[model samples]
Target: MPRKLSRLTLKEQADKALREMISSYRFFPGKWINVERLAKDLGVSRTPVWQAMMDLEKEGLVEHIPKQGIRMAEMTLQMACDLYTVRGLLEGLAGRFAAENISKKTVARLESILKEQQQIVKDQDVVEYSISDFRFHGLIYDFCGNWLLKELLENIKTRSRPFVCDITPIMSGLYQDHVEAVDALKNRDPAKAERVMRRHNLRMRRRIEWTLTREERE
Candidate 1:
C-alpha cells in the first residue's frame, strides 16, 4: 500500500508540475509532447509522466492523437470565439451579482489588489500581474451567488487559455479596465458593472483575434 501511494503521489506531482509548465507557456499551444523527454524534464519515470498526460487529456489541456502521441491543446478561432463569448456573459453576470450584494470589506480588499496590480504593472512583472488580474475577477466570482456559473467560468478559463504574443503591451489597458470595474462596484451600479465587465472581455477577445490573424505574417 505504501508503494502504491508513493506512485500516486508521483503521478499527482507530475500532473501539478505539468500544469505549471502549461501556465508559464513552457508547453505552448499545438506543441508535440515527447513522453520520454517530459519524464526527464520533470525528473520522473515515463510511467508517471504518461499518466499525468492522461489526466491532462481529460481536462482538455492536452490531447492524444492517433499518430502524433500527445499534443498541447491549440486555441482555434472557433474555440476562441465560443470561449470569449461565454466568458463575457459569465463575467458580466458575476459583476452584476457581486454588485447586488458584495460587502464593503470585500470591495476594499479588491481595491487593495488593484493597488498591488498597479505596482506589478509598473515593475513590468507580467506573470505577477496576470496572477493578480485573475484574482481580481475571481473575487467577484466568489460573490456571484451562483456556484454553477462560477465553476463554468473557472473551467473555461483553464481550458481556453488564449495565445498572446506579448503581455507587456496590454498591462496598462487591463489595469484601467479593473479600475472601471471596481468603480462600478463601489457605486453599487449593477448595470454599469455588467456593461463594463462585458466590454472588457470583448476588447480582450478582439485583441486576441488580431494577434491570431497576424501570427502567420510575423
Candidate 2:
C-alpha cells in the first residue's frame, strides 16, 4: 500500500493555495483581493481564506487597507529601489561569508552553474536565463554559513520576481559578474568577492534609480 499523505487543515490548505496563486501572477500587484471569490475558487470557507491573507500580509506579499480591503503588495519605484538596496547589502554579505567558507566543491558547483547560464544566453531564453541568474546568486547564499540569511534572501526573491522581470534587464554584463564572483572565491579573496557581488546588485539599483528620477521629471 502507498504511504498516507499528511492532511492539511483547512487554513493550511487555503494558505498554500493562496501563495501559489499570488506567485503565479494570478493576482496582479495592487489589485483588490476578493476574499469571498477566492474562498469559493479554493473550495474553502471565507474564514480560512481570510486567515491565510493575514499570514501573507506579514510576509509582505499582501496588504490590508483600513476600509478598502486586502490587495496584493505593490512595488512602486521607490519600493524597487529599497528592495535592491537590501538585496545588495545582504548578497554582498553572502559573498563575504561564502568567501570565508569557500571550498573546491563550492567553486566547482558555481562554475557549473555559470556554464549553464552561458547556454541559457546562447539559447536566447530570457525567462530561463533569468531563473539561472537567480540560481547563481542563491547558490552563494547557500554556502554563506547563515541559514537565516539564506531564508531571507529566498523570500525576497520569491516576492520580487514579477517586479524584477518587469523593471530590470537581464544583461550579459550580469553573467560576467558571476564569473568574477566565482573567480574571487577560487582565489580566496573575501573583500573582492564581496565587492563584486555588491557591484552586481548596485548596477541594478542604479537602473531603478534612473527610472524613478525620469518618472519624477515626466
Candidate 3:
C-alpha cells in the first residue's frame, strides 16, 4: 500500500509538472517532447511520466505519437473559429440572462472586478490582469442563474487558458472590450450586452488566429 501510494505521488507530481509546462509553452506547440527527457527533468521514472502524458493527451493539451513520444497540441485557426462560435453562443446567452436576472448588487460586484482589472492593466501586470479578466466573466456567469451554463463556461475556460496566456500582450484592447461589455450590462440592455460580448469574443479569436498563423509561417 505504501508502494502504491508512492507511485500515486509520482504520477501527481508528473501531472502537475506537465500542466505547468503546457501553460508556459515550455513544450511549445508542435514540438515533440521527449518522454525520457521529461522523466529525467522531473526526477521520476518513465511510468509516471507516461501516465501524466496520457492524462494531458486526454485533455487535448498533448498529442501522443506512435513511436516519437509526445508533442504539445497546436491550436489551429479552424479550431479557434469553432471554439469562438460556441463561446459566443454560450456567453451571449449568459450575458442576456444577466441583463434580465442580475441584481444591482451583482452589477456592483462586476464593476469592482472591472476596476481591479483596469488597475492591473495600468500596472502592466499581465498575470493579474488575466486573472481579473476571468473573474469578471465568472461574475457574469454566476449571476446568469444557471449552474449548468456556469460549469460549462468554467470547463471551457480551463481549456482556454493556454490560448489566453498566449494573447496576454493584447490586454489593452481586451480591457476596452471588457469596459464596453460591463457598460452594456449596467444599462440592462440584453441585446447590446450580447452583441458586445459576441464581438469581444470574436475579436479575441481572430487575434489568436493571427498569432498562430504568424508562428506557423515562422
Clashes of each: 0, 0, 0
- Give all candidates' CA lDDT scores: 0.80, 0.78, 0.77
User: Against the hidden true structure, what lDDT does model 1 obtain?
Assistant: 0.80
**TM-score of each prediction:** 0.82, 0.76, 0.72
Stretches > 4 Å off in candidate 1: 1-17, 34-52
What residue pairs clash in candidate 2, if any at all? none
Deviation of model 3 at 27, angstroms: 7.2
Model 2 lDDT tens row, 1-218? 11222346978878777765655556767789888877776766688889988998998888999888999887778787778889888888889999999789979988999999888767777666766777787789889999999998877766765463433354676778889999999888889899998998887777667765776799
The residue-by-residue lDDT of candidate 1 on 152-198, one tens digit each, is: 87777666553544567777887888999899899999998999889
Off by over 4 Å in 3: 1-56, 66-71, 164-169
Alpha-carbon RMSD, each predicted model = 4.1, 4.4, 5.0
Q: Which of 1 and 3 is the better model by TM-score?
A: 1
Sorted on TM-score, highest at the top, how do the candidates line up? 1, 2, 3
